[model samples]
Target chain A: MRLALLAAAFCALAVPALAQTSRPEPGPLTIAKQGSFFIGGREVKSDTLSTLPNFDAAGTITVDQMYVRYQAPAGQTGVPITLIHGCCLTGKTWETTPDGRMGWDEYFLRQGHPVYVIDQVWRGRSATDPSTINAVRTGKKPVDQLPTVFSAGHEGAWAIFRFGHQYPQVLPGMRFPLAAQAEFWKQMVADSAANLPTPNPTVPALSELAQKIGGTVLMSHSQSGIYPFQTAALSTQGVAGIISIEPAACPDPTADLGPYKAVPILVLFGDYVDEFPRWAPRLKSCRAFAAAVSAAGGKAEVLALPEIGIKGNSHMLMQDDNSLYIADILLRWIGKNVTATR
Target chain B: MRLALLAAAFCALAVPALAQTSRPEPGPLTIAKQGSFFIGGREVKSDTLSTLPNFDAAGTITVDQMYVRYQAPAGQTGVPITLIHGCCLTGKTWETTPDGRMGWDEYFLRQGHPVYVIDQVWRGRSATDPSTINAVRTGKKPVDQLPTVFSAGHEGAWAIFRFGHQYPQVLPGMRFPLAAQAEFWKQMVADSAANLPTPNPTVPALSELAQKIGGTVLMSHSQSGIYPFQTAALSTQGVAGIISIEPAACPDPTADLGPYKAVPILVLFGDYVDEFPRWAPRLKSCRAFAAAVSAAGGKAEVLALPEIGIKGNSHMLMQDDNSLYIADILLRWIGKNVTATR
Candidate 1:
């Protein structure tokens, strides 16, 4: 079984002397409740015939909704954590890792925090209307009017995800499980959110989720790193705390920092930022943002894993070999900073 | 909570006198192992620039794969069941009902069967390449070359899914939980399987899954009802049993029944088939197919729920209020007909 193989590999790495012994069986997960729901979608009515071959599109339909799946422990202790995935991925990003390791969602749940994972609008389980694209193909709409839909190729993702500087090349000391590279590629999906509104539908949907859940910690990664800040800017009604991991963009230092001042913030970066051309600038921008927050009488800690004696982390720090080690660091931060609001 | 609302409604219908009392809490599920994996995809090599704004597509990418999520009970006993969703839906169809009730996946798991729910190729968690569409949008490919991607409209799906004769017209005594109509509409998605080769990539992928798991009972619904037959025709390597629920099309009655002769087959139809124009012919075709299979020395049963005194079921029989009642029928059949293979 795949689990057996993973257990063996894990034991060889963690306890070489005890590698020969069989791994202990994992206990069943206990949870008080688990379910899914949609949030912040609006109905769009169309009168024209749809792009579907045999169907007429003369009815109301919902679009731009975010899908949230939640699991709460039997005796919850920590504040609820809402996880927003980056580009080209879905809630699966926080699930079982590429190499079958327990992902952050389960890890956090086991650590007593109710975890809510979301698939941003227009991606994964969150559906998007493709009528425009179909209209373009049918000449009902001009090609120029076609929405921007793109998929990340393996090579591009390899470089951008910081797996290596080039395709098929593993970075030295990188903690990514390269043996499961194929599985990682499976996580790549066609991202259609580029065609959404200026602030993106996900921003409003996330804001609505925060308010709906009363108060919760918002954790984001990569392309979605700025969502929590933007959500706070719109209205910090239920935004209790913010954790941005390896964000591709940070808020402009010149922008008003009032919305973020009251919220505890953590901007985290993995290793190889200084060595990777693309990530180095991102890290610098976040550092400036953190400084701006501090100048505005706010608390913001910009953390680089290497500075904390944690090494060999990639852009996908949560999925790396030392993922739980990083998670422990995050747990400690949450315990100290984030108030139990949920 | 949504669960509380659903529980209250459920109690009102089941036991009117007891509706005043709070519904008992659902006990935690005991799952042995749960995870997801991709199956039956191939590397697609491209030498041209990708449709992405900043990325080159000059590399290998995976497509036409199926995503499967599995959960096994703590002490599994029954044969594994592979649940394939109908058209315009995803694996979410088997997770939680539109009205927030326990889905068939959990019900089957509780019945001691490992449940494997799949997002068919080009749908849900299964990733599809958008390069061709992007090519057309960017003028790199002709509009005619664009893939046939279509999304079902609310009105169209309403009639087709047999929710009613027309939009907003519920069939008398239908069990589709009309109150959650909005939630059901959310299940509609853009289906891109038309872009794939004949027989669809999901056929081979599902067959491959059966083989990989050694053997499994293939339970398919609506559009996917024929997949089990098609998969078996290709190779019955891992197919132990077949349960086709309201298939739009059935295997050709005249086709070779060699592969199906040994496999126990159950073709089930929900209520309103004889009265609904669209479903009337489909039921006829499946009845013919079942008769043909029987004539060819195969065990095939064509079941109409009304005939068995189980009435008021819709096309989405599994999500209906009496869904578990239907599932119980299935469990009894499996107990008698399906031999444990995994």
Candidate 2:
């Protein structure tokens, strides 16, 4: 209904006199290949019983598990795009909005880009042994004894995502689709807590996936931001471009970023960024990192939407009313920057 | 372009065979009466100083000054709607969006509601002598030397308004029109700090204004929320109804709400209310107050947008993309409740 209103308003303004013409139907999406892979593994043994073999054969554990949902048209763009969701969310982030709207996965697919939405190790379809991994890392058994993870409650998300100044008290000019929050929260899942903070274990797995899929554009959100940069640095040939949205942290400012010199990196920020105490400093860090990347001869650009007439966007611009608008900006950036690298 | 595409999509879905029809332009707004008025005042004198005759014959210091901009169509609703802006913002909150879109002021006017936008004492065009007020109230000189107030910078607003999770990091599902931040920030003015927190001085002034405009619906936002409820209680005969949006504080739950028993009240909550630390408890307090009103035989209703499927709104819902949708809801509530009280 809202879309219809927007459309009616637009039509009323744009072509008041012109008669409507037949609209084109979007082509169907085809599944090129959809599957899972176990990329990284290491030997694990009990601290008290070192002689005992692990649960699986070869006395090893493959903790870095990834599940991919691949979709594209018959004559899709040669360059493929890989999407990684932020913490507490899975690949469903790219599939549908919390309010029942189409997500970027379909948008990108319709735009002719082969899309791969993935669930990182221990999330969504990916499986993991948290007890064994936690025990191996800490040399002790789990303390909570709860195997499953927890979702960030709907109320809790209000603050974490900056949806409003305060819960039950929305600020002026907010654009988050209020009706869709229930569905969006429902998509959240419980994953291994340890894996979310430092996704080092999944770095090699992501890098390997990129290599397996050939040259691809890596788009990472929130906690997943570090993975693309690490993946690009590790397997420079596999990453054609990188788009990180309000990434938690940036690459070491002074560290060698030679591998990233050929890849184009774009970091996008939504409106009202300085309200969070952490984001201001984090953005500075990101700027410094981007400067360092540029200084190291990489093509890196940081975009603050407010500076460019985009206002009142939350950190979750992907699911915003103007998500397609921002997505188009990213798509244009990719068109200009990724073509050469590919 | 986005709207056009949306319209095309809707046309395709709704009326595939029918040709487009011309949309009628909205009619112009008719001004009924627009002016300013000074309400409450008291005389002042310095201690141990030689007495000098004050400028006014009444030895007046009108601390609570108010400027009103009233508009209505040729045939308008008899029940007038009085608008009070939050802290820092003036009556312009109803005029236009930070991004140049039409505000609820015009929308409400078109909806046939006689609208009255007010600049509260010491805000907008309503001027006051802060030093005099401070001296009269505190018996000392003004402490802070800052001449004008400063608004939250664009970056600060993101977190302050919960537009994003962090500063410069918009979360997913935000709908704030990103292009208008600069203009919006530019409109924020430095208001009298003394008046914003409590706005105690303006209570009588607002009450007086309500009396002059008989049986008015007092609509207040943010900082102005408390005033409407207080004024409604003070001038029971003048206030027919009250609508508070994301109000900071609620009336004391334990207080005798006899005056309000005759007036209908609606407290509307925008998206992400639980995000701010104060909101959860604040909402509880508002609920308690509403419940107290109900228990005391008054008409009161509390609305949470999420509960009704409206999601992802920020603190500022009036300037939001779907401000009209929320406005219509308020109008409907007013239509049903205000009529009875009137």
Off by over 4 Å in 1: A1-25, A47-52, A57-59, B1-25, B47-52
What are the per-model DockQ values? 0.47, 0.01
Worst 10 residues of 2 chain A by lDDT: A49-58
TM-score of 2: 0.43
lDDT of 1: 0.81
For candidate 2, the clash count comes to 55
Interface RMSD, per-candidate values to 1 decimal: 2.0, 29.1
Candidate 2: where is the Cα deviation over 4 Å? Answer: A1-27, A30-38, A41-62, A130-150, A195-199, A340-342, B1-342
Per-candidate RMSD vs. true structure?
7.2, 23.8
| Superposition TM-score, candidate 1 onto the true structure | 0.91
